[model samples]
Target: MRALTVAEPGRLELQQRPDLLATGELALIAPRVVGVCGTDLDIIDGTIDPAFVSYPLVLGHEFAGTLLSPTAELAAGTRVVVEGIVPCGVCAECLRGDTNRCAVYDEFGFIRDGAAADLLQAPPHLIHALSENVSWESAALVEPAAVVWRALTRARPQAGARVLVVGDGTVALLAGILVRQFKPAQVVMLGARSDQAELATRFGIDLFTTDADAAGSGYDLVVEAAGAAAATAAALAAPTRGGVVLLLGYPGAEKVGLPVDDLVNGDITIIGSFAYTRAAWHEVVELLNSGALDLTGLVTHRFALSSFEDAVATLRHSSGARGKILLDL
Candidate 1:
């Protein structure tokens, strides 16, 4: 089997490896589609926290695959998505249903080999079978969608609330799309790329602009997904009095300045969300199964496993309305 391996920081290659076999309660999965994001770059560059990643690792955490063998109630040929974060169910945090913070930092594409390969090994408990109607491309997005879902759930936006999403990337776009589930009064996207206007519109955003200041403030809910220090400051200033600001982006390790006076005087609430919880993942799966969410249009690019270099290049140099880019394994 051939897999994309990051031998170390600033190094990536397609390496031939032995086929993975299902052992114990784990399932042998044949990966079909994998989604790459900005975080993957951090993993490749060794910029992410050392505690969360291991070197010589596989580079995909968001992916969907076909079950190569029957596992428990699931039959062979079942399409499925697995949770990347592996939690120790006996831990205190896990007992409280906060599995994302379960003390164990183990995860696929981090501590273990990821799904950017011909074969992947995942525990059965973490696998959720996709319904027949769901497309493989959409299934590949469950991981990122779950991350946004958890953040929105934590923010708890009220009905008819005005929403503002900052960033043109997939995470930011997904946040704009998912916020519609709460029936917001209006949803506007503040992005940097002029080419992303069409992509933002496809996500049901009627108003998409490059100027954040022109988008105006007074948003009931503001999401910062650009992952930049300037974007972080803009997010804090965009909210109205008593508005909720959700930080869904990664601003690296730098300390970003905040408007303490505005936060205190405006009664603003800023929430910093990490990864998705087990419950959040399940909810996203249910939404897909129920046909309440349609993500098929989100896929804008595709490539074969052999075209790994091209795929990475596209992700870095996207010039148009780019959405999710998938690796067809």
Candidate 2:
């Protein structure tokens, strides 16, 4: 079996590795499409927090795959997407349905070998079977979709609310798309890259602009998905009185100056979300299966497993509008 292995920070290669087999309650899967995002870049450059990452890891978590063998309830070749966060089911947080906050923080593509390989193994309970009609590209996006879904579920934007999404990346685009379900009066995106305007429009964004001031203020809901301190600060300032601000991005150790007076005087709600819970993952899978959400158009690039270097290069620096970059295994 061949796997894209990041031997350490700043070193990545497609190496021949031992085949992974299904053992115990684990099921074997052959990853078909894997999405790479800013997190993957952080993992490759060792810029993410040390506590959340393990070195010499496979470089994928957002992926869709097929069963290499039948499980108790599914047949071989069944399309599936698995939850990245492997929680301890016995933990207090898990008992409370807060699996994202499990005391034991084991996750795929972080501490565990992920799906960026010919074969991967995961516990059957963590796997959700996808509909046969779901495209591999769309299924591959379920993980990240679940992340955004979890944050939105927590924020609970009301109908006709004004929403502002900060960032032009995949997560931000997903946020712009998914926020529509709440029937917001309008969805505006503040992006650093002008090239993303067309793509944002396709995602149902009413406006996409590089100017922060043009984005204006007084949004009922503001989502910060750029994973930057500047974006975070903008999000905090965009919300109206009693508005909700959802922080869905991971900016690492960077800190933003808080508007303490405004937050207190305006009665704002600030929510910082982590990874998705099991329920959130299931909901996203249901949305994909039922055709309520279609994200295949977000896929803009694909490369073969052997072309891992080229994929990383494109991910690091793409001259054109980039959405989701996938590895077709």
Q: Candidate 1: what lDDT?
A: 0.91
lDDT of each: 0.91, 0.92
Q: Which runs of model 1 end up more than 4 angstroms from their true locations?
A: none
Candidate 1 per-residue lDDT over residues 28-90, each given as its tens digit: 999999999878888888888889899999879999999998988799999999999999999
Report how far off residue 165 is in candidate 2 (Å): 0.3
Model 2 quality (TM-score): 0.98
How do all models score by TM-score? 0.98, 0.98
